[model samples]
Structure formats: C-alpha cells, structure tokens
Target chain A: MRIFDPHIHMTSRTTDDYEAMHAAGVRAVVEPSFWLGQPRTSPQSFTDYFDALLGWEPFRAAQYGIAHHCTLALNPKEANDPRCTPVLAELPRYLLKDQVVAVGEIGYDSMTPAEDAALEAQLQLAADHGLPALVHTPHRDKLQGLRRTVQMVRACALDPERVLLDHLNETTVREAKDSGAWLGFSVYPDTKMDEARMVEVLRAYGPEKVLVNSAADWGRSDPLKTAKVGEAMLRSGFGEDDVDLVLWRNPVAFYAQSGRLRLDTPAAGATFEGNSILRGTPGAPDVPAPVGS
Target chain B: MTTVPARHDTPADTGAPGLPPGLDGPARAWLADALTEAARAAQAEADPGGTWQIRFAEAGRRCGPGHADAARVELLAAARPGVADLTALYRQGTAAERRAVLLALGRLEPAAAEGLALVEDALRTNDTSLVAAALGPYAAAHLPAHAWRHGVLKCLFTGVPVAAVAGLSARARGDGELGRMLRAYAAERTAAGRPVPHDLTRVLALTEEP
Candidate 1:
C-alpha cells in the first residue's frame, strides 16, 4: 500500500520513524507547523521552524525515499500567546514558499477570542494564497468545538471544501461530515481514534474525502498508526481501493489543491551507505578517515 | 503493498520522444478534448484566466500520472501560451505542471533566452524530475555554458540519470571546466566513504575529448 500521511509531525520524529514509515508503505507526509509542547517566545522561532520543514526535514526524508511537505500556521493554542501572535503576520511570506501545502492546524484550541481572530485571519490567508487548511479542533469540548468550527468555516471567506477538520471522534463525526469539508482522523496510542475504531469510522462513513493520519509528535503517539489503520480496514472487509483512497489519494487530492505537493522521491540512487544522517562534512578530519582495503 | 497497475512496457513508455503514442485510447480521447479547450482558450485572449490553468492542472488525474507529462506537453502546444502565461502557470502550478512547462520550452519557439529563468529556477530545486526537465533541449540550445555545467553536476548529486539530460554529449564534449567539476565531486564522494555516481564518470569521459 502506498501511504500518504496527511498530517504527521515529522519535525519531532526521529530518523528511525521515517525508516519504519517507509517500510510500512508511507511514501509521503505533510508536517503541519504546530505549537511545541512548550511555548515559543517569538515569531523568529516560527520562521526557523518553517525553514527546517521546507529545507532540512525534506532533505532528511529524501535519504529514506520519502517525500516531505509542510503546512504553515500560528497553531490554535499559540494564537492565544502574545509572543507568538506575530507569527500570524509572518505566515503570509512562508505560505508563498513551494513546500507549504496549506495554512493549517488553525482552528479552536480553547475557542478564546484571540483564537477566533487568528483562525479568521489565517482562513483569509489560505484564501488569498489559494491553499487548503488543516484545522485542529478543540479537544476539551469536543461537540461544541466541532460546532463552532463548522460555523466559523461557513461564515469565513474560505470554502469548507478547502478545510480539513482533524482529530475527530464519534461524537463529532456526523456534524463534520455534514459540513461539506474533508474528514480527518488522527489515530494515536491513547487519546484520539485507534486503528479498530478508525476502521469502524470508515465503515460508517464511506472513505470519500476522509484522510487518516498518525498525528505523531514528541508525545507518546505512534507514527505507525496510519499503517495500522490501513491493515485494520483491510481486515474489516474493505477492499484495496478503499484503503488507497483513505490512506493515499485523498490526502494527495486535498493538498494538491495547493499545487505544491512533490510526490516524486528526489534521492533515487543517492543513499550514502544506508546512513540517512551522515552527509559527510567536507574537510572535517576528525570524521572517519577513508580506509582503503 | 497495494498493487499499482504496472506502466505499459511498450517501447514508447521508455523514452520521452515517443510518449504520446504510449497513452491508451481513453487518455487519448481525454487529451483531444483538453487540447480543443486549450486552443479555444488561447484564441480568446493572452490571458485565458483560471479555467485554463485548472484544466492544465487536471491532466494528471484525467490521464494517468505516467502519461500526464505527455498530455501536458500536448496541451502547451495547442494553447500556444506565451512567456507570461507560462510563467504564471509555472509559478502557481504544482511540481508536475512546472515540469511540463520546462519540457515544452524547447518546442515553444521561444525568443532568445525567453524561458531561461524558468529553467534556472527548476535547476535550483532538489526535485530530480524538475532538474531533468529543466535540462531538456531548451537548456541545451540556450542556457549559458556556466549554468549548464552546474546543471550537469546537479544531476550527479541528485541521482537523476544523466541520460535524461538532452544534448549531453554535445554540451559536455570538450568542456574542460565540467571535467574539473566532475573530478572534484567524485573526490568529495570518495573522501566521504560514499560511492561516486557512475553517471559522473560517464559525463567526465565526455568532457575529456578536448
């Protein structure tokens, strides 16, 4: 199965995660810029994070034969932070870059007034840039957050079709489906949906515009949850095409709206002795001296 | 693993020159309609607007991804988009769309160095598909010797087969600077305990003729 994890945070993942993902049929990923576990002090920090997603992370993924792209945003939780609010202003410039597939993780965290302003402003950015959005609904008040999210999406200038309301569960799935937006479910180890539950969601709602992701990060989340969801779907009477739609094509179709998704693996024959991290620093003598047999 | 349909193994599938012939009947029919729409769009005005660009973007889904490149080349020819249109499409278009524009540059009957910026932009990218497309006949026919030499080296670094580079023999033959660059690259790879790309040696041999 060729997998495209529509919303995995590869920035916080290790190199081994990338290798295991590739082995499990993950060929491409979109790492949306979100708040780290701790608060960031300034907008410059966000720019550095965006640059790595655009440059360094993609280079790292290329060594393992995975295509990496990212979505840029002042994430929902950070929108409330005064120090990080400047990232909203910085987002337009980053959105212009080729690797940015969407203006994302941009909905309600606590549904505060500040979060409202940030979400509305970023929705406008996505519209102006002709990109899609990956919205992270509030986890505390599940049904209320999904309601407010759907309402805001309808009221905003951006089309709901361009929005992906992620981290959904059984309580909010029906409303999200009725909202004319793409469906996104993040399978995790403890919270959020698991593989069997994800398969059940697939069973109830046919996998039309649904995108399944691991949403893995620095937390105790599993990056292989997406691959597990694919296996579960197969075991539960879903055909191969249904699995492909949910796992691969749906994400490609959604992010392809940005017209920037490069699915082609750049490092075809460029592996350096199976080590993804070692690019061989030039003129560094302390690094292993070349030994001739 | 999900079984993707294996691409047709006909002779035309292997080479760009014979690509259009490799497409099956449904894809051919789809291309015909798209071309007709593109021609009408070109005749309408210099800027045919979003509808035309959307059609250009849909070539991949309309035809298979394997055949989309050729389908786009045909659309470009039929539309006869000028430099402005090509630039907008390339800038706003996906990697796939940008690649199609680069491939069509040589056949576009361009003015002197007309689409050179597009080729240079594609060369700057690490995407191997875009790099290979940028070094097509357009680059060979027009790109300055300095940038062209760097492009050859870019292929070796990115693992794009040097064979994808159009007019490589004529461009690389008797070029001493390219030979020097290739030698430096090979030495760096060797020092790093990495296998130097075999295509680098093949290109170096071409540069040795002078």
Candidate 2:
C-alpha cells in the first residue's frame, strides 16, 4: 500500500499526522507551493515560505522517516494581485534550487488578464528551468480553464507531458488527458471528488497519466484522502498493484519528470553536524550546580 | 509509578575521581557554578522579557567545541539526576526543552506529570516555531488532541520546512502507541485539507506484510 501523494502541504500538518501517514503506508509526497490563507504581502514572505518548503519541512519529515519533495509556483489566485509582481520576480531564484520539482499550482483561477500574463510568465520560467508545471484549474468554469491551460501550455511551447493539471473534475480530466498533460484529482471532504469517485476515476482511467492527491492545506480538505482512495480501490476488488499505481507510482512517475524530485529515506542514528542547518540555538538549558559549588 | 528505563544506557567513563581528567579544580568549579547560575537565570528569564539573550550567549560561549569534556561532565551529572541539562544549555529554550526536561523527569519518577502539564500549557504561545518544536517531539509519545495534530499538520504542509517535520516525526517515532495514534490523527487531519508530515509518508511506503 505504498503511495506517493503528489500534491500535499506539509506546512499545515503536525508531526502526529506524519506518523499517521507513515502508518498508512505513504512513502513519499510532493508539496506544491500555493496561496497561504491570505495573500503574501511581500517577496520576503514568499522567500521564507520557499525556504521552509525546501529546508525545514524536509528535516521535519526525516524525523518521521518519510521522503519529502516539493514544487515551486506562484499560485494563480494571487497572480492577479498587484503586490504579486515583486514576488513573481523573486521566484526564479527559488526555481533554481535543487528541491524545486516543478513550477506549479500555477494556472487559472478567474482567468483574468493579469492571471493570464502571470501564468504565461511562470510557464516560461518552468520551460526555461527545465521543470514541470503543476497547473491549477479553476473551480468555476473548469472546462474553459482547462482549455485555456492547454492553449497556454502549447503557446508557451512547454512540453505537454511536463504539465500537471490539478483539481480536475470529470469534465476536465478527459481534456487534460487528451492534451497529453498529467491529470491530478484532489479528493476533497465534500467540494471536490470524494474517495469513491476517485476510485471510479481510477477504474475508468486505469492509472496512466493520472495521480490522486488530497491537495490538503489550511482550507477544508483531507490529508489522507489519497489513502482513502486506495481503500476504495481495494474495496472495488482492484489489486494492491492497481492501488499502488494510482496512489503511489503514478504521482511519483509524473513528478519525476521534473528531474528535481528525489525520494529521500531517513538515516538511522544520524547525528547533526556542528555547522549543520539543525545546529542552531533556540533556547537555553538548565544545569544543576556541583554539590559544593 | 511506572519506571521507564533510561533512553540511553551507555556507561560513563569517569577519567579520575577527584580531578576530572581535562579540567583543573578551579575550572571545574567555575564550569559547575556557571552552569548552575545559567540554569537559574534561564528559569528566571522564562518570561518573554527575561534576560534570555544574555543567558544564551553566555551558555554558547561556555559550550565551545573545546568544552567537550565539560559537555561530558554535564551529561554525566544529568544522567545521575535523569534530567536533560544538555538540551537546556541552548538558551531561551522553548517548550521542546521543557518537554525534554519533563521526559527526563518522567524517566526519573512518574509524578513528573505536573511538570509535563506546565510545559504542555506553554505550547499555547503565539510563536509557531516554538510551539511546533516543543510539541512536535512529544506528540507521538503523548498523542494529544486532533486539533494539536491539526496545527502541526498545517505547519508542515502549507509551507513549513521539511526539517521541522523531520524533527517532530523523530520524536513521535519513539513511541509505537503514539505512532499509531498519529496515523489516525493524520487521516483525520489530511481529510480536513492538511498535509501529512513526511514521516507518515515513509510509513505509507512500507510494503504491507502478506
């Protein structure tokens, strides 16, 4: 029951959740950068966010013994905001970092002109950096959003196979698959497809060019929806292999196209180096005096 | 009272009885006094406006690489008392330090639950890093409420760094019961749109036994 959750946000979760996911057999995860609950006010915020994604988040995962990877993107919802331009300018530095697997969660929300420009700019960045693009389709007008995504990918001369169209419903999944783009289904608690529907999608799609994720974040969603999808597949008489392909293999294969996604394993009995990232002082210690001092 | 054996059981090598090998009597006395004073200062400065910066800087200066023997001396003393004085050496310590202290206390005697509770209450600070670091390690062994786990999940997924998640995971991994509780917590948390920490992802990667 090994799984690779292609789209998850570790920043919103606790260590217990990590332990739980490990218990459920989630082997690897790809965290695609998206909007925080509120729009980030400055480039520094974005930088901090990126640093955490690549730095602290992975270290945290290692404590739980999971392999973690990430994608970098300027989310579509925030692209239209005037303050986003400076943040956008700063994204290139992050794209060049080794842990950035894709320029992602970066498609259309409202299909505004500014969003269009921002998406195109990011798509170009992805192409220039030789990274994959994780496209976030609109919740509303999804069909039109999917069409625009395909049109933009083609216009940008981006490799279709290197793009992942996320949050796809049944209406847009076919179009995304037809366009040679990787299809990602976000199994939500209520709004998006549920576990049963995700299993049906897998049954219909047969696991090629498809990946299932929770797209879990601060909003209303489930982090273990991917596992539930696996559960659903098993209940449907699908072999463990089929469940593995849909939940783990497919996402890993799709995101691996970026060349930056590396599945890490925790080292046993590893100690921190004096100059290592973890070797910083957070607080002071309490020591007792010698008996006669 | 349940007596959990010492987490680390390696025997200490006492160089010489009266004069610890590397340190002179005055140096040893100085080291011991400095450490005791630092500990008292840290406790006094536990409040937000406390002289934590000064205390921490002094502690760091005292804990140079050259003080390897000093570190060993502290560890030996802590082992006898069953408290993690080494972790406390880091200045301006967070709830994490407090937890380590409490766990050490718990190992010494079961009545340490009061100390654990105080540390747990301190976790409600506005500082996300401090809260995460403090609660992350103990969550596995303690298995606090789903909301606590939810907060941790949020930190890890929304943009929290992998390193923090790894730290929390390692701490949680120490207790199997806590580990199982965390798995269930992860399912619920992820269901609500939070990302599972990487440690859970590793657990998921395991091949189920036939």
Candidate 3:
C-alpha cells in the first residue's frame, strides 16, 4: 500500500507526523509553498521559506523514510502583498532546483488584479521551467473560483494538461475535469472531503488524472488521509490497481513531467544537517519507573 | 534503574569532528569528492565563496545527513575559512549549517577563541541540538567559567543531557558555585512539584566531587 500525498506542508508538521505517515506507507510527498499562518513582512521571508522547503524540510522527511519534494511560488494569498511580489522574480532560480517538481499553490485567493498577475506570472514560469503548476482555487466561491482559474489556464501559456486545480469539491469537480487539467481533492479530518466522500468522487469521476492529498498544514488536518482514502477505496470494492492509480501513480505521472519527482528515501539513520530526529538515545530513555513501584 | 552514559572531556567523538567514522563506501567517496572541490576552491588565489557554500549546503543531500557534519567540517577545514567567513556562515546559514560551523570550530582553530560568539549564540537558543553542539570542545575550552556554568544549567533546563556538555567532570568538580546553582534548581523544581531531572542529580554529584 505505497502512498504519495501530492500536497502536504511538512514544514508546518512534526517528526511524530512523519513517523505515522511513513508507517501508513506514505513513501513520497510534494509540499506546495503556502503562506505562513501570519503574513510575511518581506520577500526575503519567502526565500527563506523556499530554502527550508528545498533543504531542511526534505532532510527532515528523509530522516523518517519519506522522500520530500516541494513546489515553489509566491502563493495566491501573498500575491496581493507588494512585499511578497518580489518573490515572483526569485521563482525562476528556485524552479531550477532538482527537488522542485512544480511551481504551485499559485492561483486565486481574492481574484485581485495582483493575484491575477502573480498567478499568470507563475503559470508562465512553470511553462518556462517545463514544470507542472499546482493551482489552489479559492475556498470561498467554489464554482466561480474554479471557473476563473480554468479561464486563466485557458488564457495562459501553460497548457491545461500541465495544471492541477486543487481544493476542489463536488460543485467544482465537473468543471475542473472539463478544463483538461489534473483534478486535486483535499480530504481533511472534518471540513473538506473525507475518506467516504473521496471514494465517492473516485467512483463518479473514475480516477484518471485525479490526485488526492491531505493538504495538511498548520491548520487542523490529517496527513494520513491518502492512506484512509485508499482503505475506503478498497472497502468500496475498487481493485488494488484502482487504488494505486489514484493514490500513487497519478501523482508520480503528473510531477514526473518535471523530470524531478525523486522517490528514493535515504538510508536509515541518516541525520539532517547536524540534527537527527533522535532524543535521549535511539532505543533507550532512562524512564524512572512508576515512582516507588 | 538509571543509566549513566559514558563521559568524554575531549572533542574527538563529542563534537562530531573529522569524517564521521563508519561512513559506508559511497558516502565516504561523496565526501572525498566534496572535500576535493572545497580544497581546490580554497587553493585558488581568489576563493569562489559561492562554490564552497553550495557544496556545504548540498552535503546533506549528497553525503546523507549522518555524515553531513563530517563533510561540512572537512569543507571548512579544507577551505580554511577565517573568522569573518565562519561568522557569515553562522549568521546566514540555517540552524543546521550554524551547528556544523560550531562543531567545526574545535578543529578549525583548536586554541583560538575566535568562534566564541557563535558558541554563545547557539547556547542562548533552546534548540537542544544547537545547545548540545554549542557545548562542544570549543565552548568547553574557551567559554568563561561563569558562562560555562550557565550553559550546563541550560542543558539541564532544556533536558539536554549533561553528558553532551564536553569536559563536564573536570569543570563541575570542586565548583562550589555550580553546586549552589544545582541545589537551587533542584529546590525550585521540588517547590513546584516537578520531578527533578535524573541529570540534575548526576551533575549535582559531579559538583560535589573534590
């Protein structure tokens, strides 16, 4: 039951999450760059964040046997901030990084002219870099956001096949599929699509270019949703091949278009920089037994 | 039952100096190539800073992180960076990179106290790894007695094992002030109904030694 969560924020997550995700057979992940919970004051903040996504986060993931790749962008929400727009200029060099499989989480937050410009610029950057674009649709107006996003894809240089429209629900799924772009569904613990709902989508849409993700971040989300979706698919009488197509193969195929998508986990016991995710000792912690037992 | 890990008063194994021992063949080879590149950059009349910095940043990816520190130390050693270069690397580098610089300080300039600022900077943070790395032989050999004592207390405070503090026994022995500090900390924890760390007792015993 190998899994590849196409969009998860490992930077905001912890080592415990990594252990559980690895145990659940999450062999690979693609962390799209998104705004921190608070607004970043400068474009330098985005560069540092991008560096972590490239360097530190991947190292952290490798320690727990998960191969980590990231998509670099200004992100839709930050696009409106003039302070963050300079990061758009920096995206080309970041896009050239080996671990960067796409330029993404780049779409509309408010559908402002600034967002339109940033999204269009990043989509062009993706096209120039020969990478896929992970476009996040606005959470407020479901169908309208998808329509506007699909229109942008139609107008932009990036082909629809090279785009992935994310945060989709039933209302937007039909139009997103009609756009000829990849369809991405985020299953959360409570808010977004759950395992049963995801399985139903697979049944309705027939998982061809569909990618399911946890979209887990600082918010309340689950990193194990992909595995749960796989389990739900199995229970729904979908064959193992069907499960593999939706859970693993689809993400690999889309991101592999970048000529990146490294899926190899590093050797066991590898540390990141000087930090190993170890505390006390690897197999021993001197626990003071039940006091006075 | 409580286990007391082995204590080392020196740098060899404590600071992760030199190429980490037992690196598998491929890792060793990758490190060799990286070091050679760094050495060549250093030998050039005008060192290409970006080249070496890139190699330093990529060590974790190329050599694997278990040996990344060893690779970084060797890169620093091979490049023979001065205080300014080390300072820039520490300030601009990530926490991991800063740690590699701290660990390399002992080997880069064994006697000079030039790297103390980096050590002090690391000690201020609660990052256990940085705190542990900051207390490496460089700090043990150079940090003033007063600062060193606080670092030890910090180890206990952050739950970093006192064992990670290099030269613990020699420094802690016969230090009445350290004994006082340790006792006060224990009393505070007791007053708050917190379980005193097993390490507090261990260090307290060390301070009690003549």
Candidate 4:
C-alpha cells in the first residue's frame, strides 16, 4: 500500500529510516518545521534547518526512492525569543521555494501574547501568499489554544479547510472539526494516542476530515507510527481505499491547496542544476566551467 | 573474469608532462581495464558490500570530478596499495552530495582504507563538530592504521598533496614496504611542527606509536 506520512520530522532520523520506509511502501513524507531538541541562538540555525528539510533530507530520501516534502515556519516554541524576528523575515524566501508545501507547524503555545503575535504574523504571511497553514496546538491548555487558533484564522478570513489544527485528542478534535478545519492526530509512543486508541478515535470520528501522523521528532516518537495506524485501520475493517484516503489522499489534497507541492518526475539522466538545494548555495550559479574553462 | 579490451585513444593531456618514461603499454592497458571494470561495478552496486571494490577501481582510473570517469594517468599515483581516493572525492564534493556518497561508501567498504581516508580528511578540517562527523564513519569502518602521513610530493614539481598520496598509502596499510614508508613519513611530519596536510589527524590519532 502506497502511504504518505503527512507530518514526520525526518531530520532527527537516519538513512535507515529512509530504507525502512521505502521497504514498507512509504512513497513520500511531509516534514513540518518544529522546535529542535534545543533552542537555536540565531537565524542561521533556521536557515540551516530549512536547508536540511528541503535539501539533504530529500537527497537522503531519494537514495531509497522516497520523496520528501516540507512545511516552512517559525515554530511556536521558538517564537517568544527576541532572536526569532530575523528568522521570521527569512521565511518568505523559503516559502517561495517549490518544495515548501505549507506555512506551519505554526500556532499558539501557552496562549502567550508572543505566541499570538507570531501566529498572527505567520497567518498574515500565509494569507498574503495564499498558502495553507499547519497549526500546532499547545500541549498544556490545548483546548484554549485550539479555540484561539480557530478564532484567529477566522479573523484573518482564512478558509477553514486550509488550516490543519494538529496534535488533537478527544478534547480538541470536535472543536477543530466543528470549525471546518482539518483535524490532525499525532500518534506518540506514550503520551499521545497509541495504535489501538487511535483506532477507537477513527471509529468515533468516521475518518472524515481526519489525518494521522507520527510527529516523530527528537522525542520518544516512532517514525513508523503512521504505518502502524494504517495497519490498525485495516485491522479495524477500514477498506484499503479508506486507509489511503486518510494517510495519503487527504494530506496531498489539503497541502496541495498551498500551490507549492510539486510532483515533477526528475528527468532520467538529468544532471543536478548546480544550485541543487541539496548541494550548492541556494542562489549560486552552477559550477562555472571550473572557474574559466 | 572476462577481461574487456582497453579503449585506446591519444593519452589525454592531464596537465602532467609526458607519460613516465619506460612505462609498459600492455601493463597500463591491463590496469586501465581492471579499473574500468571496478568503476562500472561501483556505479551498478549502490549497496554497502561493493563500495571498496568500486573505490579501488575508481582510484585506479583516476577520473576527474565524478568517480565514474575513465581512468586518467594521475589516478595511478593514488592506486598504490594504501591509497584512499574515496576520501579525496568526499573532500572535493559539496557537503550534502559528499554525505550521500560517503554514506554509501561507508556501508559498502566500512573496513576498507577508502572509509579511513574519508574520515581522516573530515578530522583534518580542525573543526571539532566536523571531526566527529568524519570519525563516525571511520569508527564504523573499524580499520585502524598505526600512523598516516598527509603531504609528500609524488612527482617533481607536481607536489600532489598528502590527501592524494594517502589514498594510495591507505591501500597498503598492512604491507611491510608501504608500512615503512608510511612510518618514516609520519616521523618527518612529527619532527616538524605541522601536521600532515589534507587532514591526517584521524589517521594519526589511531596510532599507538610516536
């Protein structure tokens, strides 16, 4: 079964993950920018992170025949820092790149004023460019943050379907779906829903407007949780098509609305455009005939 | 093994002067044929098992830029027993590109000298963060040489850097003749204040002897 893990953080994973994903029939994945294991001190860290998400990550995935895509954003946990403004400034350039699919994992954490400001700024950026957003609800007081996110998206006049309110559980899923926004569940190892519990949620929710992801990062998360969810769905008597819709089609349809999810098949024997995001500088010209031929 | 005939054309000018006098035509052709087979094999086998064989063959060819080129005469200097051309390739390529090649090479030839040189060059950069990156693969390969030298001039006026020569020396790490040459070069570098150029720290650090 072809699968698309809609929200995996592959930067924390190794080449083995790519190989295993390929072997497991995972054809593609979406990596949303998130707070790294520690705080980044400068804008360069964000730039490097974006580069890895779009650059090295894709190349690594390609070795195992898996396609890699990413979302561009200034993560919520990092927004409160005074050093984050410059990084926020650099977001537009990355968003314009062909592989960036959404302006997200961006939203409120702790319902702080700084979180509100960062969320509004990115919301405006997303609106200005006509992109979708992937919102991250806070782990504590999640319902309050989820409500705030819904209100802010409405105030900004963003299409409800264009927003993906992620990290939902029993408390926030109904409100997230009631607002006409797409609902996302991150299947974590212990704290979040396990496979059996996720099956129960799917049974309750009936799979409409729902997406499941691993949200696997530098934490105690599994990179293959989405696959596990897929397995659980099949065991729960969901048809293969229904399973594909939630894990693959739903994400592709939602993120594609951002107008940046490119699916170009690289030409056979086509050489890299010297400025391959994976190799050379972003705007640098291809190696110029060895500096004068 | 079925040997294919060597492709013959005018010896291309590789910025080196005339071919070394008295070099046998048939032996050169044979080496070129073997190297060509190795290069072809490397390109075909992306798995970890065939990496060193690919590197040895590619180094023998001495192609430019990409390892998948026709063997040039310059490759001969690096084809000697202990040479590690794969490391030089990693140094010359961009970081992301190099990481892919290095990862594949590390897996296929983890214990080969090709793996060692790649790690050694990564260490020589003198950047602590990058040293661990280089050593990660080096340690994975699990082959340690007593000592290594980086900067010995191969041909007069050519001044091929230590990284280039070490690729050859790496292949001969277990041989008596090559071992003596490597130790003496290591001694000379130690006597001088400078470490061998082209990043010999990873290689030297593996040594127990002074």
Candidate 1 or 2, higher DockQ?
Answer: 2
Clashing pairs in 1: A1-B1, A1-B2
Q: Give me the TM-scores of chain B across the candidates.
A: 0.86, 0.35, 0.84, 0.27
Chain A only: TM-score per candidate? 0.92, 0.90, 0.94, 0.89
Tens digits of lDDT, candidate 3, B141-181? 88888668878887887779988988999888888877887
- Alpha-carbon runs more than 4 Å astray in model 4: A264-293, B1-210
- What does candidate 1's lDDT look like per residue over B61-114, in tens digits? 766798889888888887888887888788777899989999999888566455
What DockQ class does candidate 1 belong to?
incorrect
Please give the lDDT score at residue B95 for candidate 2: 36
- Quality of candidate 4's docking, in CAPRI categories? incorrect
The predicted structure with the larger TM-score, 2 or 3, is 3
lDDT by candidate, in order shown = 0.81, 0.63, 0.80, 0.62
Highest-lDDT candidate: 1
| lDDT, residue B208, candidate 1 | 94
Q: Estimate each model's TM-score.
A: 0.55, 0.55, 0.56, 0.54
Model 3 error, position A253 (Å): 0.3
How far residue A214's Cα lies from its native spot in candidate 4, in Å, is 0.8
DockQ of each: 0.01, 0.01, 0.01, 0.01
Q: Across all candidates, what is each one's fraction of true contacts kept? A: 0.00, 0.00, 0.00, 0.00
lDDT of 1 by residue, A1-293 (tens): 98999999998998778878887888899999987764566899999988888888887777667888999999887776676798787888889999899999899864668888999999989999999999998654456668998989999888888999998877778999999999999998866778887887788888999999999998879999989998998899999999999999999999999999889877433333353365465432222211110
Task: Give the alpha carbon lDDT tens digit for every residue of A72-117 in model 4.
Answer: 8988867766666578889988888888888988997545577788
